[model samples]
Target chain A: MDTTWSAIFTEMGWGMVTMVLNLLKVLIPLMVGIELLLHYKVVERIAPRLGWLCRLLGVGPKTIIPLLVGLLLGVTYGAGAIAEINRRTPLSKRDMALLGFFLFGCHGIIETTYLFWVAGASALFVSVLRLLIAVLVTAAAARFFRLAETRKE
Target chain B: MNAFTKVIVDGILRGLKTALMLLRVMIPVYLCVTVLKHTAFFGVLAGAAGPAMRIFGLPGDAVVPVVTGIFTDEYGIVAAMSGFAFDKAAITTIAMITLCFHSIPVETLVTRQIGMPAWKMTVYRLALAIATGVFTGWLAGWCF
Candidate 1:
């Protein structure tokens, strides 16, 4: 066990530093840019426009706040934002399930977009495909489960 | 409202909203990254599980999320994916599979909180995730 531990540590020691540095490089700019955007209320105006579209996927306009946040930020943050919204507005189980499905396909947009870009793929293609898949899958799941019918009155 | 003023107001508000929303997200994400880095246990587990992961075309170090799913959840799995270096097609396929079913502990807990049966959610998520992973991986490998 000791030998195994040592071997693993030796290999990953360098990776840990690189990982930390890389994470900071990506996250710092992301946070700063996001802060700038929020300070200007960019997402606020965009949210209403997306409401009609969100409804088709079985989510309310309220849910779009976290979905957009998750896309711009990442999943953990997205989930955190949703949890906060749910606390205040109280989402239904059906809505939560739908949100889960939507998130499964499309969170961490910027990070994933950058990754695709670095890999020689079109970032727009990746983003659009992910959103398309998320919407289609969520819609199918919502329909299959009769989520709308199961909603609390 | 005049066109120029409306445009300026819209742009300024939009920018502010986006920034605040970003700050909200960055705090939690930064914490997650920090904890993941300092933990020695994750590296050990990843090493131990390395052999089994290779069968799926993942690196030996890739077992961290699989192991994490046994205890915590799939968020760790997604975090793990962010740390690796696979081709675009491979990463997307793996991510799809992971997103479908990787965080057993977390998914089960959340589903139960929402009143779904944990066992059913587990079985359903796992089965769907594996099926999706295999199919997508094969298709991606073939096409790309």
Candidate 2:
């Protein structure tokens, strides 16, 4: 019983340390990059070009940074991007919620799909299904919100 | 050069602050999961959620990895599932569920920081994940 308790504590300690370290390693570099990009107005230049994606997700053009970051990176990193962007140029509540829904369902697509593929699952199947589900659900929610707004008006 | 240096410093500081905030969620959840794994409670949970696997057309054993994935992360799902022998369809179904739902506690906190309420985001993801899992199950069975 005592050994089991010690083992549990040890595992917890190690897990927390590793998790935090991993988060910092990726997050610090990512935050620096975003800051540099924003400082140079790179995001502004890129945001307009992603109009098609903005339309597809039914969000504003300014959301392209966070949306792409969240899709390619992971949820936590995406949230970082969202918060930073929101601080700079406020996103509508609707846009934030839509992004939350989309990313929470399917962030880190390539890495995740690749991991699963290496684990023996079909790469095409997992990646396609995950993206499809996230896109469909987010698009449906956006449509619902639009209809509700029109009804109110 | 001076402005660039300031931006770099600001970014690092912000990153550190955010990392600290995240640790507030990650540490406790990690401890809880570790403790749970050391007890019979983990297996009990697997058993309880086992029946629900049928909804996704997954086997009972898939619950172990699915539940682990929810509390932990994608790596946890793979690690837990290493002991099992799941078919292609089952693997795909499980992947669908975990992809949508993994790292629930930490990710929910991250979303909560960005103006979405924690409970609302959690519920939304859980519902969407289950729905996707079920759909993937049916689709996988038909296709593969």
Q: Pick the candidate with the highest lDDT.
A: 2
Local distance difference test, each candidate: 0.59, 0.76
Off by over 4 Å in 1: A1-13, A112-128, A145-153, B1-89, B99-128
How far residue B43's Cα lies from its native spot in candidate 2, in Å, is 8.7
lDDT of 2 by residue, A37-144 (tens): 668877457767887877888988777888877786566667888889878888988988888888887887755776676566878877776787778888899999
Per-model TM against the reference: 0.59, 0.71
DockQ of 2: 0.43
- Per residue, candidate 1 scores C-alpha lDDT tens digits across B37-79 of 4468757766777665544555555454444434433334434
Q: How much does candidate 2 score in TM-score?
A: 0.71
TM-score of chain B of each: 0.55, 0.66
Total clashes in model 2, counting residue pairs 3 or more apart in sequence or in different chains: 0
Candidate 2 C-alpha error for residue B137, in Å: 0.8
